[model samples]
Target: MGVQFGSFDSICETAALVICSLVGTAQGIEPSCYSRNVEVGGTIIFQPSTSFVHIVAIIMTAIMIFHIRSKYTAVGRKEIVMFFYMYIVIELLAMFLDSNIIPTANSSYPWFAAIYTGLVAAAYCCLLINGFVGFQFAEDGTPLSLWFMRIACLVVFGVSFFISIATFKGFAGFSYSKPIGLWIIYILWPIICAAVYVVSQLVLVFRTLEDRWPLGDIIFGAAFYTVGNVLLFAFSVTICDAIKHYIDGLFFFTLCMLLSVMMVYKYWDSITREDLEFSVGSKAAVWEVKDPLLSTGLDYSEEDTVSNYHGGGVAPSLVGGVSGQQLYQKGGMGGRGYPPSDRY
Candidate 1:
């Protein structure tokens, strides 16, 4: 029975592939350009320009992680940091994949592609989840919020990975030749996630915040993300041909994506202020200002102390020559180190 079911599934996949190919052709869908190769010191590199951009992006993401860590008391610091970490992983894998470090004919190529697809989906999911972190729905940075984002992104990755692998290997009724599932996961899923994230963040900045600078960051992020997709999917071949194979849309796509990610960090940082008292790495500076009115009626003369002492032991005046500045330097006078309200 299992054999029969497998055969039936195979037949269905083949039919689906045929139908999808016809539909795709009718819709004018075609493969994007393959970036040009380069030779440096007799060593060949595939997608050289895009790969270099990916490396730079990875480094930038690492720096972003450091910046995020320094926030220390941002509302969603831990939660958003996860997104950048995943982005770094995706960029590293992209560098490997685009450079043909793992060639298409390699046995592990499909697995790498599957993992890349999954990480992309998970990253977008993380972005979407982060948009809601501002709403205090589950208390950002708490165990509940942090764990929920982690588990949800993990689930997204698993689902995306399974779909991508199944399609690549032509199992579970998924067809590599058609790859409708891949289109859904890779193309439509990101679009959905991005749209939702943008909308949510817009609402947050417009309705919830007093300052509107974050709105600009959000808009710039959306613009960069959109341009990246448009260049990659629509103009890659044209750009490659126009550039004489020296570069391609993939380079611009990667650069734009990096800018988009930076905008995400900018927007997050704009909305969340670091609490200096609890922040790491440096002590916050504190300034003490003496109020002129605080010493309006105070007397520190020894004569006053002796006079008050003779009159049934009233509280002694502050010792003479003990200036208000000296008292302040000594950290005030009361047991709790604050001056009495009636005195200086």
Candidate 2:
């Protein structure tokens, strides 16, 4: 049964490849320029490199869904939800295009592409947002430096969004032809965003060295995401030229998978630790006996004792086996219950 479904999926994928190839051939453009690779009849239809990426994306989508449904913290939950939402949108848009519901050959397709691209763009933006939120609400607390990083990320996204819009307009004007202006908008803008994010994250990692916190996770996770985006942008540029585009897409997909796994593990560990501590502490208190007789005549003369038990006066009988003499000397024999002379 599993094999049959798998075979069916492969056939559907091959059909999608055939359709894309036909569309590209009819439109006088390489189908490889559109995405990763193409496959036909259990063989390479256009480019084989892209096939692996599509496969990984399909697998990762399932894993992401699992993570989203499981227990997660507020930040983890938000990031997973955003990521899943973006992917869902992208998948739906892709299906729409593949089904010929939206014309990818005409000028209208560019608009459709741009809209779908914008949706895909949100995947990275949401990740950046998650990193910022994590840094802001870290165990130690929100720091000014983290806030600055968050703002910097926002600026980068804003600029990238603007450039993406311009790029889409250029594409709409030109039917998938290569243009320097288009390259600047599509390629350079994404590169800049990646570079800024990477550098900013590196700076944060170095600056917070002395701080006792989970700085490593933040730095490494951000670095993975940044590098992945950079590679993806490059892949988008060279997708038309060679099979390398598919390989690059595979790399980017793998990077995203790693990032998601890291986040899930990190937060899961934190949640588990917190639960463990609470469980142990609760159980410890549950077995505690509140014997007022054992505490009697104990001299809590030390300032630490008063400070420790400031909530209420310690019951003298709670002490195990101390004499009145010791109690008086320790100054715990106060005027509350026992008189001064009575102590001797």
Best by lDDT: 1
Cα-based TM-score, every candidate: 0.75, 0.43
Q: Which lDDT value does model 1 have at 280?
A: 74
Question: Which tens-of-lDDT digit does each residue in 112-194 have in candidate 1?
Answer: 88898899999999999998999899998789999999999999999999987787677899766566667777668888989
RMSD of each candidate? 12.5, 14.2
Best-matching candidate per TM-score: 1
lDDT of 2 at 105: 53
lDDT of each: 0.75, 0.44
Runs in model 2 lying further than 4 Å from the true structure: 1-49, 72-76, 91-108, 137-185, 196-344
Q: How high a TM-score does candidate 2 get?
A: 0.43
Q: Tell me model 2's lDDT, rounded to 2 decimals.
A: 0.44
Which 10-residue span in candidate 2 carries the lowest summed lDDT? 1-10
